[model samples]
Target: MRPSTQIKPISLLKTQTAQVIRRVCEDREPLIITQNGEAKAVILDIQSYEDQQDTVALLKILALGSRQIAAGEVKPAGEVFERLRKLER
Candidate 1:
């Protein structure tokens, strides 16, 4: 978060929606939308949102791999590579 970033009220969002959208896209930062001085929602550009989703998906995959390893459901790297090579043939 930037030092200059401020929480915007819902009223301001309703009135200056276009400006908010433009700023979010240009800055690639999420805007905190507030209501009654309470944080309510977040506004993000499409690309940033997609990037966040991708990052979360990758984290989930890493966690799953760790769990599998802990459960002893793992294989040797060399054997996995050999199977892949056979599949490529």
Candidate 2:
């Protein structure tokens, strides 16, 4: 995040929505939309938004796997591979 990046007021969004969209897409950076000097929302390019969603989904899956492991709800590696091989058939 660059300190020099200007934060736009929410009111400007009503009139400069297209400009904001173009800038964010071209720079691949989020625009902070502010209201009354406080951060209110962010505008992200479609690719960045989807990438963020994917990252969050992956993190959730990893968290679930960690919890399962902690609960001893995991099979041995060889056993898991054997089951996968059977499924392949």
Per-candidate TM-scores read 0.86, 0.86
What local lDDT score does residue 86 receive in model 1, on the 0 to 100 scale? 100
Candidate 2, TM-score vs. the true structure?
0.86
**Candidate 2: where is the Cα deviation over 4 Å?**
3-6, 86-89
Error of 1 at 20 (Å): 1.1
In model 1, the clashing pairs are none
Clashes of 1: 0
lDDT tens readout by residue for model 2, 1-89: 68458578999898988888998999998888899999999899999999999999999999999999999999999999999999999
lDDT of the candidates, in the order given: 0.90, 0.91
Off by over 4 Å in 1: 85-89
* Residue 15 lDDT (model 1): 97
